[model samples]
Target: MLYIFQDETTSTVAPARLYKALTIDGDTIIPKVIPGFRTVEIVEGNGGPGTIKKLTFEEGQHIYVTYALHIYNL
Candidate 1:
């Protein structure tokens, strides 16, 4: 089975800051912002275009893995 989640938001903040928070500081920020996951790990790339992230839910040993792909600028 496969599940997909997508989110899009517009912010008044600087793009660089938002990028840093999403990529650089993401591992640290995720748990605090979304409390259900037991752990979050950057198992692959460093939040780059081909990066991968894993979220673990210990209750059922469920894992959700995701990767990023670079898309042309809007």
Candidate 2:
């Protein structure tokens, strides 16, 4: 059997602008941070749990991921 591991990270950004950026313009924001994707879109949910997001790459391939939106103050 093979095991896969995932790492968790806490990214700190200006809370106010980051919120607006993510909620308003995630497609434009994420690609700048994560390579290999040109654009992203919310396929479901209203910025809550059980949300589905789609990432479209430059080569025309698409990937889907389920996401949760949870923000905390530091």
Candidate 3:
């Protein structure tokens, strides 16, 4: 049998912007960093669980991940 592992990390920054080279446009930031990511797409939802995101890369790589939203009243 084989086993798979997954991890998550969260970083916080001001709601400010990054730069023209690294625009804060939606969530498609692959091509900005690599400049050859080809394409990245996201399925929009009103911010909730069960949302799906799809990504495609120039190196023939693809991935699908589901978004789970967590909310807290600070």
Candidate 4:
């Protein structure tokens, strides 16, 4: 469960790698960082925009997964 609602911004040790955080392959960091999630795998689409990602977690019983589509600027 999420705790208090607070605003925060953190500086990263790797600035160049930070940009990849929003990219397709960069998304693996989410499930790796976030709790409850066992593994974050790419389900469909290529790599950039419209890529659908499947997230498996312990909280949701692993039966159903949330889908996220990559949105690219260019």
lDDT of 1 by residue, 20-58 (tens): 988678788877787676667767776667766777755
What is the C-alpha lDDT profile of model 4 across 1-74, one tens digit per residue? 32333356788548567666746445577767777777767788776566667777776574647465544355
Worst 10 residues of 2 by lDDT: 65-74
- What's the TM-score of every candidate structure? 0.58, 0.46, 0.36, 0.56
State the C-alpha lDDT per candidate: 0.72, 0.66, 0.48, 0.64
For TM-score, the strongest prediction is 1
Model 4 lDDT on a 0 to 1 scale: 0.64
lDDT of 3 by residue, 1-74 (tens): 33444456554644355433233354556655665466545476543454444445566455433443343455
Q: How good is model 3 by TM-score?
A: 0.36
Model 2, 1-74: lDDT tens digits are 33444466666877787668866677688889877777677778775655667777666555554444444444
Ranking by TM-score: 1, 4, 2, 3
Stretches of candidate 1 exceeding 4 Å from the true structure: 1-14, 58-63, 69-71
Clashing residue pairs, backbone N/CA/C < 3 A, model 4: none
> Which number leads on lDDT?
1
Better of 3 and 4 by lDDT: 4
